[model samples]
Target: MWWSKSKVSSISSPLPCLCLLWLIVPACEAQQQDLGALLTAKCNSWNTKTTLSFPGDGSFANVTERWTVFAPPMYSAAISPATEEDVVKTVKLAAKYNISFLATGAGHGYGTTLGKLQNGLDIDLSQFKSISVNQSAGTVTVGGGVRMRDVIDAVFKAGFEIQTGSCSCPGFVGATIGAGVGRWSGIFGLIIDALVSVRLVTADGRIVQVSKTSNPDLFWAIRGAGANFGIITSATYRLHKIVAGANGGGQVMNADILVPANMSAAYFNALQSFSGKMPANLAAVSIVRYDADAGAAGILANWDYMGSEADGRRAMAPILALNPPVVSISTVPWNKLFATAGFGIDPVLCENNVIRDLYSANVRNLSASTMQAAFNKMGTFYSDHPEARGSVLELETFPNQAATSVPDGETAYPWRDALGNMIFLFSWDASTNSATSTAATKLGRQLRDDFVKTSGYPDLSVYVSYAHGDEKIEQIYGRNKLPRLAALKKSWDPRNVFAYNNALPTKYP
Candidate 1:
C-alpha cells in the first residue's frame, strides 16, 4: 500500500538549530525556554545515552521525517533515548512538563490523526537498535527501533524466518502493533501471530514485561493496539524454519504479470476461485495503476508461491490463462521477492515524504464484480487527472487459515478471516491542483464504501495500520475488541498520552 511507481525528488537538507539549553520553540518562547531548560538538564543527567535536538538541528529531521508528508506531526524538540530506562525518563519528563510527545522509529506512521501532535516533544527510538537471535530458543529479540530490514537480515542470517511487512523501512514493532501482514502471512500468520512478548513503557513511565502469561491483558492489547498503550522498548517474536531456502535463505516462485485493462474481470474471477481454498503458501497482490502504454489502467499481479516451479505454474494456470502482455517469473531467495515485485525497480516506491491520501478495507471475499467496479473506477480516475497517475488500487490475497486457527478473542487484532486487504492510495506531486485533490478524496471514499457494502460483513473491518484516519472507532478496532481495548486503554493510558495512532479513546461511551 505504501509503494509507488513515480520518482520522487530528493528531500531538502535539514535546517540547523543552536540552542544552549534544549532547542527553542518558535512560539511562546518565554514559557518554552523554562520547560526546555528543565527537560534538557533532566535528560542530560540521566547517565544514559540520550541526545536532544531542536527544530533546526541536523538530527531533528532524521528523527521526524515520515513516509508520507501529508499532515505530519509538528515537534518543538526531539529526544533519542538509548536504553529502556532512558525511554521511561523521556516519557516521564514529557508527562511531568505537560508536553505532548510521540515515540517514533523509522517514522513511517501514515495516519492523519498523527498531525494532531503540535509542538510536541518527539521520543525518537532510533537509538534502540539491537537484534538478538536465539537459534536454540526459536525466537528473535529486537529493540523497538529496529526496522523490518534489520530483523529480516538478522533472522535470515540465523537461518530462521519471521513474518514482516514487504517494505524494510517501517518499525518492526510499530508494524506488528498494527497487525502486520505480507507475503509470509499465508504460511505463518499475521506478524502479530508471531509475537512472543514485549518490554513496554506505559503511559506513566512504568517499564513492564507483557506476555500471554504476565500482564496478559496488556499483552493482548499490544498485539494490535500497542501504540495506544505506550512505547515498546523491545519485542521478541517466535521464529520458524525456512521452507525452500537451502543456500542461506528460503526461495519461492515469484511472478509479475501485467493484465490488460479489459482483463480485470477475468483476473479477479480467477482470484475469487482461490478465496476460501487459497494454498497456505501461495500469495498474490494485484496492483491497479495507469498503464500509460495501454491508454488506460491495468492490474499488475505479483504472485509468490512457496512450492516447486511446476506446482507454482499449475497454481497460477488460472491467471496465466489470461495471456497477460507482460509476464515475468523467477525462483529466488525470499528477500528477492520484492526485487521484481510490482514497480519494485522504481527507487521512489520505497522513498519517504510523498504526499498520500491512503485508504484501506478488509474484505471477507474476493467478489469479482465488486472488485471490477472498483478497478474501473480507479482506471477512470487516472485518466481524468493525468497529474495523479501515480495513484493505484491494490488487492492483496493471503490465506486466512493460519490466522483464523488461533480463533477469535485470541488477541486485540480482529478480522482473523479477512481474505483480502484492499488498499486505495491517491498519490500526486506537490503541484497538483485542488480540484484533483477533492476528486481524489471524493472518489476514494466512494470506492471504500462500495467495497464495504459488498465486503460480506455486516460492518466495516479496517486494518488500523492502513486506515485513512476517518473510520469510526468500531471500524478500526473490531466491535468485539473495542470494549476490552477501551478498558485496557483506561488501565494503561488513562491520560490518553499516546493518542496519535488512529487513537482509541480513554473510555468508549
Candidate 2:
C-alpha cells in the first residue's frame, strides 16, 4: 500500500480549499487580531507550501457532505520539528500572540479533542521521532512523535522490546499520556506504567523536565490525562526483554449461543462465570457484527492469545470447548498475531465505536443471564445498524505485581481495583455516511450508559483518551481526583492555553 510519486496524482483528492473562511476568520475582532494574526504570521513564517497543508484535499466540505470528521479548522502550516529547539520556538511564538496550539504525531485519536482547535497552529512532531535505549540505565529515551512501530523497531534493534499499542501508527507521546494499554499487559503493564520522566513545554512557553523529583504533582497528573498540562517533547521509560517471536493465536466462540435471549441478564451471568475462572495468561473478549454480504446475519466472538503456540492452545481450551470456531488464526510472534488483527498499510481511516466500562461491578458478582441479555441487545442494535461493523471487544489484564499496585489516587487515572479493562470497538466507513455515523455514535454512548447502569458500578472509570468528548470531565477522572487535577491545571496552565482538550477546568484559585 506504499504510495509512489506517479500514483499520487491519480488518486482523487477530497477537498481543495478546506473551508478556510469558516476556520481562519476568528469569531470576533479581538480574536481575529490575536489568534487569526498568529496563524497567518506562522504560516508566512514557515515559507513552505508543503508544510502548510495535508496530502489529502479532504476538508469541511467532506464533513458537511456526510463525513463526520472533526478536523481542526486551520491546519495550513504543519511544522515538523526535528529538535526540542523547534518546539520551543513554536511554543514561544504561540504564547506571544495568545494563539492556542496543539501538538500531534500520528493523529490517530478517535476523540476530536486532539485536533479541534478553532484557529490555532498545529505542531506536527513526526520528524522528531527517534528511539534510543540506554542499556546500562535500563531506560529508553523516545521522541514525542515516535510511532509505536518505530519504538518497537528501535527497542528490538537495541536487544529489548517495550509494550506498545496494537496499531503501529499511534505515536508514543500521545498514547503514553493517554493510557498506553497493549498486548503485554498480562506480564509487563501499560506503557504509562514504565514511564520515568518527560520533557515538556508549559503553557507560557517554559520548557521543564518532570519526574518523581521535579513537579511530581504534574508528573502524576500527566500520565493518564490528555495533553492538558503541556506539550511533551520526549520521555524516558523503563525497558524490558522480549521473546523475539513467540507463537501466538486464538479461537473464536459463537456469540449467539453464549448470549441468551434476555440480553442484559445473560451478559451479567457470563461476566461472573468468566471472572471466577479467569486465566491470568489468557486475554480474551467477545465481538458482535452482522455480515452485510451475508444479509445481516449474526457473527460474533473473537480472541487473541499472545503465548507460545502450544500455550495459546492450552489457554484457549475453554473458549474452544464452547463450540467449534468459525475462524481461527494463530502464529509465532505477538506482532504477527496482531498483524492478523488488521494493522497493515490500509488506505481507509478506521473509526472505532468504543464503550469503555461495559462491566461496572466485579464480573465475578454478575450473573450469566445478565451478561446474555446485554449481548442480545447488542446484537439487535447491530442488526438495526447495518453500516456498523462488528464490535472488537478488548480485555487487558495487568500483572498485580506491576504498576496496578499504585494507589488509585496516586496517579490521575483513578481506576486501580479492576482485574482488567474492556472496550467494545465498532468500525464503519468514513465516507458518504454522516447521518449513519452520528447515529452510530449516539448508539455507542447509549450502550455505554446501559452497561454502566446494569453493572452497578456508577464509579467505574473511563480512559480519558478513549472517552467521548461530550462526556463530563468528572466521569473520566472520577470525583476523588477532580480537585487535585483542577489545581494542577491551574498551576501549570493558569491562562488555559490548552483548554481546548478534555480539559480539567480550573474552577478555583
Candidate 3:
C-alpha cells in the first residue's frame, strides 16, 4: 500500500501522463476563454462613456491598488462610469448575468469583509466628481466620487464649512452614510446629521431620491445602513457658516506633544480626568506605540481647538502640565488645519500594498486600571513580534455632542452613548512571511478582547468603519435593531447583490 516514488516511476507509462494532462489543461483554458468573451461583450454593450479594464490589462493594476493589500479580491473586470446613467446601465447589465458587483469611489474602506468578493465586477465611480454650492440655501450638493479635500476646498471658498472625516482620501458620500465622525462633530454635528437628501441608484436599476418626506422608511435606513440599500450617485448636505475669528476669517489652534515612556501613566490619568469634562470646541487624541529598535514606548497627544491661541492654551492646560519632551503649537486658517495639524493629508500612511488589521471598541470611560493593563499588554505584544514595531493604539476622547444628540432608535448607528472610541491598528509589510502576519493578527485580537474585559462594559458595540470582519451583525448594529435592518435588507436588496462590505443578510438567523 505504501509505494515509494522510485517504484511508481518504474511502472509509469508516457500515455497515461499525457491523458491526465489533456483532461485538466483544456478545461482551465476553456473557462478563461469564456470569461474573456463575456467581458468583451459587456464592454461593447455599454451605452455611455465608460472604460473597461480586464484582468491582465495594464490598467488593471491601478484599479486594484486602492487600499489595504491583504487578501485583495481578484475581480474579473473593472468598469469606470462617467455619469449617473452609466452606473444605472452597468448595474442593469451585471444583474442580467447574475454577476455580483461593488461600487468603489476612493476605495479607502478598511473593513476586511471586502475580501469575500471573488471574481465579481467592480463598478468604479471615481469619475463622477462634481461640486455645486447653493449659497442662498446654505447647502452643497456633491457627487459620490468626491473626496473630503474636494468638499473642504469648495465649501471654504463660499465661507461655509461641513463635517468630514479626518483623512482627506475617503469619499465624502461613503463617510456620511456610515455616520461620519470628524474633528468638528462636537461643534456642528455628525456628517449624517447634516444630510438633506441623497440621489441613489437601487438594485432594480431605478434612480430615486430619498429624504424624510420622500420614502421615509428608506430614508431612515440609508443614513446608517446606506451601503446595504443601493449605490449613492450624489448627496446634498446642509452647511454652516465658518466660525469667524475676531479679526475676520476663521482660525484653529493645533497642538502636538510627545510624552516619554516614564510619564505615560501620569499622562493617561490626566487624559481620563480631562475627557470627562471636555469642552465642545476641543478635540483630542492620544497614540501609544512601542519601538523595538529604540527599546522604549511613548505616547503622542494631538489636540485641536476651534478658536484663538489664548482659548486653546486655557483648554489644553491640563495636558501641558504633564511636561512632555516635545511640544509644538500653532494657530492657522480653518482650511489649513489638516496640513498643519498633521492628522490628515499623509499619503504614505495609507500607501497601497500594505497589510493591516483594524479593530475598535467603545467605552464610557477609561479607568486607570484598564489603561495600565493596555500599556503592559502592548509592550509584551511588541516584544513578542519585533516585526510589528509599527503597531499603535489610538484613544480619541473628542466631544461628540452632535453625534450623541440623536436618540438611539432614530438612526441605525447604535453606539450613540459611547464617550470614547478606541482603535487598535496593527500594520506590517506585506512581504513578511505568513507566520509573522498570523501571529500579529492573533496578538491584535487578544489585546482587543482583554481590553474589553478589563473595561467592564457589557455592551461590546464597535464602530462599523473599524471592524475586523469577524464580528456578528448584532455586535456592529445592536441586537434590538438587527431584525429591523434585516427586514429592510429583505425589502430593498432581496437578492443581496451588494453583500460585500460588512454585509447584512436578507433574513435574520
What are the models' TM-scores? 0.91, 0.76, 0.89
Worst 10 residues of 1 by lDDT: 1-10
RMSD of each: 6.6, 8.1, 8.2
Considering every candidate listed, which one attains the maximal lDDT? 1
Clashing pairs in 1: 16-56, 17-56, 245-250
Model 3: per-residue Cα lDDT over 297-353, one tens digit each? 777678888888789888878888877878889887767776666444246454666
Write candidate 2's Cα lDDT for 394-479 as tens digits.
33333223445566666777654444454545555545367655655665666555545544456445676666566666767778
User: Which is better, 2 or 3, measured by lDDT?
Assistant: 3
C-alpha lDDT of residue 285 in model 1 = 86
- Residue 250, model 3: Cα distance from true site in angstroms: 3.1
Model 1 misplaced stretches (Cα beyond 4 Å): 1-35, 46-49, 243-249, 343-346
- Residue range with the least summed lDDT across 10 consecutive positions in model 2: 59-68
Best by TM-score: 1
Go through the candidates in order and give each one's C-alpha lDDT: 0.80, 0.56, 0.74
User: What TM-score does prediction 2 earn?
Assistant: 0.76
